[model samples]
Target: MAASKTKKQVRKSQFKLTSEQEADLRKVFDIFSKGGEESGYGTISAEDIKIAFRALGYEPKQEEIRQLISGVDKDGKGLLDFNDYLAIMTKKMTQKDDVEDLQKAFELLDRDRDGKINSGDLQSVAAELGYFTGTMAEDLQEMIDFADKDGDGVVSEREFLKFLKKTTFE
Candidate 1:
């Protein structure tokens, strides 16, 4: 009788990494993997995970690393395989990029570096963009009103972020 062969199932990740990103991740993983250059499939210890995170520009607390490992380490081994490391790193990198982009936008809108977005800031930005007109005060006030959730007459960083999240996500 002929033996039936079963194919290994490959799980698809929701997040996709580019070739350069994948290469960088592999380099980091191999550097810390238990097998080093030999097996290329070994897991890394918790301490190794912390070092790897730093090498990748993350400064997570030890407790945060432990929690992340616990969440992603599928075999309950308290170690990270390449797949787990990739997932965690991908998520962290994406989150950091999002926050950085948001911060840049907020700084541009803040104009005077006062940590808040008021009508003056809006007017300055509008004028820079050639959108300012003689009657733009009412329009700018409307914009501020839309974003000022706490009725504070201005948008703080937290409020601006909340407004963006609401508009973008919903």
Candidate 2:
């Protein structure tokens, strides 16, 4: 009998570090991109960040770029890790309509009158948003089951938010 092989799945995340750590990551990234120049290293300017973001497939507006660089250690002493960059990266900075729709989605997901949303809320919201099938409540439950992290019977707000953040790649 031949054994069946399964490929390991690589999970993609928006960030895994703090805002300050993101700066550090950015410094290392920039230096590597600049041929590892150590002496009189040039700062990663707003323009540079903008161009980099574009390369990363995100074309944020000038104001958004300015905001992202506002507190950067302009001397390149501080760096931006993946996590730090995530806060600014996923934001709907340039498009007002997109922000409004995102807000609406947030509102719908926050079920049970709680300020936060869980996986159940996600199922309902997804259904309302027409992202699923079979109009049955059981169907929604099954979808929620797939995304719920804690077996405690509900997906926490943070988990739902994480699911949203991760689903971007799909």
Candidate 3:
């Protein structure tokens, strides 16, 4: 007997949003799209995402949310999104979490595949985020060092997962 594989049908794009959902999502976008409103980085903050999800009656894991937000990392620069807020939020289902999403985001951030986010990439991402300062490079490098437990000068999957877990939905 021969086996047949079923191809999944793909859905095209649409831009229809209920007025209330649109308003709430937009509010969230504005909050995140702003640079360093709280932290010195323009990157989307955890607080911003929590508010957004709360508006939608949802409480997603922050790391999961970051993976979802990664979809808005459109320029392949490993930076967070600022312009595609509404489109990304509306397309949330495609950004849902899984082990694969975790791996992908990590890979994207780790430009050299040395198992960690390098200071150069981090600084570039932060600058694109409109939040970079000379000292931020040192601070982020320290975070990398703190997170990279093996002293291999790179963050292994285990280390990354530990950090990810800290951001997960309880």
Expressed as tens digits, the lDDT of each residue in 42-159 for candidate 3 is 5554446666666666667778777766766666454454445565566553333334467787787776667667677677778878999987878988878987777876677778
TM-score of candidate 1 on Cα atoms, chains taken together: 0.66
Candidate 2 runs further than 4 Å off: 1-104, 115-135
lDDT for 87 (candidate 2)? 46
Extract clashing residue pairs from model 1. Answer: none
Which RMSD values do the candidates have, in order?
8.9, 12.8, 19.4
lDDT of each: 0.80, 0.53, 0.62
In candidate 1, what are the lDDT values of residues 16-126, reduced to their tens digit?
A: 689998999899899888864586778778778888988988898888877777789877877777888887788677656656777789999998899999999999988
Each prediction's TM-score versus the true structure: 0.66, 0.34, 0.38
Return the lDDT, model 1, position 102. Answer: 78
Model 1 lowest lDDT segment of ten: 4-13
| Model 2, span 1-170: residue lDDT tens | 12332211222122244667456546544643443245524334344666666655566778866666555535554444433444454342223334445556667667775755555676666677788555656765665666677765555555665665567423
Report the C-alpha displacement of residue 166, candidate 3, in angstroms.
3.8
- 145 in model 1: Cα distance from truth in Å? 7.4
